[model samples]
Target chain A: MLNFLSTALVPLLASLIVLAGLRRRLDLFACFAEGARQGMGSILSLVPTLVALMVGVEMLSASGLLELLGRALAPAARLLGLPEALMPLVILRPISGNGSLSVLGDLIAKNGADSLVATAGAVILTSTETTLYTAGVYFGSVGARDTGPTIPAALLSDLIAVLVGGGLVKLMLFS
Target chain B: MLNKIWAGMILISTLAGLALGRGAELSGAVFTGCSRALSLAVTLLGVAAFWSGLMHIAEQSGLLAAFAGLLRPLIRLLFPGLGRGGGAEQAIAASMTANIFGLSGAATPLGLRAMAELAKGQPRGMASPHMQMLVLINSASLQIVPATVVALRQEAGSAAPFAIMPAVWLTSAATLVAGVLLLRLLTALARPRRQRASEKGGLRRC
Candidate 1:
């Protein structure tokens, strides 16, 4: 069942059913085309910001800045009772989901399925999001100028999630 | 603020790259990064377009309204600025549902549409409180069923992959609750400051 959903077949199946059901009242193709056009336009407008952010992120990661930051934060992670190795996962969790997902896959492979680190990684991933990416895309789409308090709020939430995830794993599995 | 962050990222990365004596690597990363972003946009174009269309059908079929009705009370509290029974509410509800289901891919278009709606009639540079709430809520997305994590565990040969359900549920719920409370607190704190500014005519622009 999880595998079935993993393929995104569930949403696709549901969309097909919905479209088929609505086709009589609405011109489904026309609606889809209009929506697709709008989506494309937003995507095109967002390319510049996306490229800027992605390049920044890539440089940070490739230049070993993330590793350096992760190393510096290791003690804090340890203080939260999580493994020091999870430092990278915590650091990368909010910036890029793909980066963190790969890190998570590696952690699970290295530490086994039911290990505390892997469990915490899964929980953290579920709890948090790709903050910078989502904010950039969403705000860029809407042309909202002031991120205002959103970034700080999101980062704080990510920090809390990381701590709570590790704490929960420690209490539930370790204790 | 975004400009500063962007500039800071480039500056810091470049300096770090040069300090680490990896100038060649950093220069290469800029091109690779742009290409990666291009591919991402292309990938998102397909998903966003399909979902946007499907969402239109869902909206037309009244399915989205039903979903909105289900989540109305909570959404109403978060978006008091929106008028009653508005389409934006439906879009937001759909996006929130998708987020909960770990369908972030499908949620993007709906989320973007919601922001577009929320920003309507508002000043160009200012994000409404409601918009901030939506972004913060999305940032702390609560996944009830993390299918990807479960699948990853299964692939790793976990005997019972669902065993992590308790931890996932706890973490996500806790984060969401904390996020809402923090947003409330921050907004309350900001209100007085804004009220004072209004007296000085600074609030007229907003």
Candidate 2:
């Protein structure tokens, strides 16, 4: 039932919006086209920042530093009752969404999708945003230079999410 | 701050790569990253364009305003300084709506719009507390469905992909609450220092 709702949500939303527009005698096609054009412009403006950020992230990963950082944080992970295998995902989660997704995929493949680690990873991934990416794009759009405690606060929140999410998975699934 | 972080990432990666004799891999990563970002952008373009168009219709039809009306009290609590029925408020509502529905691709465009709106009339290069608050909330995931994670779990052959929904809900709520509280605490802490510094400047001028 939940799966059905999840799958149907987007299409249902689209249908409702269209129906709403029709009822109001709105030129839905023209409105949509104009919005799409605006959307494309905003996205085009983001490309350079995205490229720079992604390159930095990719370089960090490629240089083996990310893996090393993960290993370095393994003890911290263990102290928090998290699996050592999840260290990399934890590190990458805030930096890069696709990187963390691939990491989650690897975790599930190795430990089985139903394993505690994979479940915990999935929960964490779903619970937190890619902080760096989101902040970069949002602030970049407006050319806002001073983020003013935003990143730190967001990262702290992500930490809370990870701890709470992973702890619950351990309590419920591990048991 | 972002500038520093970006430069630091590149510098550290290059230094580490050379030290570890992974220069070749680092160079390869540059091109790979660009291509990856481009492909990601292309995917974002399609999803964002479709959602933006739909949302535009929603806006034209007054559906978005109605949806945002339901969230007005919450918005008032979050952004007390914002006036009623402003562009910022509407964009924020749209962004939050997209976030709750787990339409992140749609959320980004709306969020960017909100940021742009919040930036207006403010001093150049400085983010207002409201803008920072918006970014903080955006960073704290608020999705109910988490469709992407569930779909990925299904692809990974989970017998019950959505079983983790409870955990997701708990964590997302906790994170958002924590983020809000922390931001408030930080703002309160900084206010005193700011005032003292300004007063000190006033004294020096005298």
Candidate 3:
């Protein structure tokens, strides 16, 4: 399957990407219209979720909840050799990749980027998804809310990514 | 939230132990170390806001659609669940946007916005499950540019920061395929048991 994803899927998908540019299929404009409509509609909701999550995280920081979460998750983080504070970022990364990228930036700087720290940060870049983001936009567009076990499953999957990322980095880059 | 702090404590202690084991004078200096991260976090909050907003604007302006038009069939193949409908086209397009650009942060709000839009008239209870599918797919996300990784390598002063792109591409392939397979397997395994239980319970009896 992995072989297919890389050898077959990626190449085929990338090559077919040229089809989008064929001047005849002006449907590009329509899709943009669709995206714009979707974007405008969600702007209002974005305000609340952003404010709530950002403020909640900030509050967690001030209230020492961040620290507590770190300690509690230390064993788990150690298993991945990640910083406990990284947990929140891990949680947030899948929801907001750029936000986590920004966080990973800070981690790299502090840890002397060339070390395992930077390498692990890089692995995280490849691993995990933005949970809230994907769900919100996809479901809102289609109007489906029955998400089933996607959340739990994705979380578990990302956790595995964290471990794999750390292990790989430790061997290739850090070591 | 307070209870979650234990993880941090453990991490700090482990690092401290490492510091001590290494006999470094700066051992147990996590407080001093994270100071940089705190300051950076403040700066990044704005950066995050800007980038996310930019992605929204891009999506709004049709940049993503242009990209999506290019990859429709392949995406359809990857996300058969999304089908070939208009929404599937858009969803796959948005995903492609996030992946190619490495806008990991921007993808979240956009993803949520995507789901809300997708669920517009889906059968009532179907909303949550479909949204979960979106999340899972996003989590198993693939990347090409890997801006974050490059940034980390540069910060670390790597000899060739972007050299690892090949590895990243390879690993992402592995993870994505594995993740999809795992989810499918789990779902398939759970279906019968769920049916049995649901049969016993039923939705209603007139």
- Whole-model lDDT values for every prediction: 0.74, 0.81, 0.56
- When summed lDDT is taken over every stretch of 10 residues in candidate 1 chain A, the lowest stretch is A1-10
At residue B42, candidate 2 shows an lDDT of 69
Greater lDDT among 1 and 3 belongs to 1
Question: What is every candidate's C-alpha DockQ against the true complex, given to 2 decimals?
Answer: 0.42, 0.50, 0.17
- Fnat: each model in turn: 0.67, 0.76, 0.24
> For model 2, how does the per-residue alpha-carbon lDDT over A1-175 read when each residue is reduced to its tens digit?
6446645766788899899999999888898999878767766777787788778777887888877887888889989888777787887789877667656755676688899989999999999999988998888888787777889889999998989999988876567
Give one digit per residue, the lDDT tens place, for model 3 in B1-206: 22243344345545544544532422323443344444444443443443344444455445567776877776666556665757645764676568665565456656666666555666655644445555566767677555445544654577666655555665666666666666667677777987997889956423
Candidate 1, superposed: residue stretches over 4 Å from native: A1-71, B1-66, B194-206
How do all the candidates rank in terms of lDDT, highest first? 2, 1, 3
Q: What is the lDDT, from 0 to 100, of the residue B206 in candidate 1?
A: 42
In model 2, how many backbone clashes occur? Answer: 0
User: What is candidate 1's CA lDDT for residue A42?
Assistant: 65
Candidates in order, TM-scores: namely 0.67, 0.71, 0.58
- True lDDT of residue A166, candidate 3: 62
Predicted structure 3: lDDT = 0.56
Which one wins on lDDT?
2
